[model samples]
Target: MNWYLKVLKQYADFKGRARRKEYWMFTLFNIIFSGIAISLDNATGLAQMGVGPIYGLYALALLIPELAVAVRRLHDVGKKGIMLLVVLIPVIGSLWLLFLLVKDSDPNENAYGANPKLIPV
Candidate 1:
């Protein structure tokens, strides 16, 4: 949960490296929260009423942060944050991005900043 909170605290920050644990933990919580919101919305008949699910609202609010974290995660792997644009290429692009995100951060860092996982906390 600290990982998730850390990412949220950073918010729109896109200038640093983010360890895989930080990025993946935040993503796990985001999916969990969104699922809960969607369940509640469905139970309340929001979907039937065309009022939309709370998950949609939550996702909209955090879109920027999500993108920023992803970019930072890419940076952690020594790739330019702009490489995130590859997602726009459909299936292959998204799979490649997933591969990148799951990769270990550069051991010694490569300009974005020190490896968060290697820094003594």
Candidate 2:
């Protein structure tokens, strides 16, 4: 939950590294919210489809932060943030980003900064 708040706080940040917790936590909340919107839309029948639009707008607004986090997360892995775009190749792209997200962070700091995951709370 704290991680979700962290990303929102950082919002447009694209220069620093991001820990896996931060990325995944934000992802989780996004999914949950989208789910609720969809559920609401379904529960109220087509007349309530407006719920989907609301959440769909929410998602569209989040695109920058999502991309920012993706780039930063790749930085944590010591990879170029641009590597994120490689995922555009369908399954390969998704798999690549998934690999970076789950892959271990660099053992030492790279250009982005000290490993965020290693920062003492």
Candidate 3:
């Protein structure tokens, strides 16, 4: 999907705001790909040997991009990227963070940059 590739292209970029579509699409594709990778590792007997090599490698490669997109998603909601740390608190923290991420973006730009929805993309 274009959204998934877009996130990958940005790679480790942690600046700017990412529209909800971008973040959710990336998450969707990441889940699909991870499933495929795990399936491949299991089919190849890699899981029995150790951590599924394919899944492990795939997860490791996407770690930075995942964080970057999440930070950007938080920015879109007008929250500081540091708010991502709230996920470490407990069940409530994760629920709160989910609430923030799903919350609509600020209609106007804040500190991050112009809203992607408002930009003539």
Number of the top lDDT candidate: 3
**Candidate 2 lDDT for residue 116:** 83
Candidate 1 wrong stretches, greater than 4 Å: 48-53
User: What global local distance difference test value does model 1 have?
Assistant: 0.88
lDDT of 1 at 31: 89
lDDT of 3 by residue, 1-56 (tens): 99999999999999999999999999999999999998899888889654497999
Query: Candidate 1 at residue 16, lDDT?
Result: 89
Candidate 2 residue lDDT tens string, 72-119:
899999998889778889998899779889987887989989988678
Worst 10 residues of 2 by lDDT: 46-55
List candidate 3 segments past 4 Å from native.
Answer: 49-51
Judged by lDDT against the true structure, how good is candidate 2?
0.82
Best candidate, TM-score-wise? 3
Measured by TM-score, how close is model 1 to the native structure?
0.91
Per-model CA lDDT versus the true structure: 0.88, 0.82, 0.93
lDDT, residue 102, candidate 2: 91
Q: Among all windows of ten consecutive residues in candidate 3, which has the lowest summed lDDT?
A: 42-51
lDDT of 1 at 102: 100
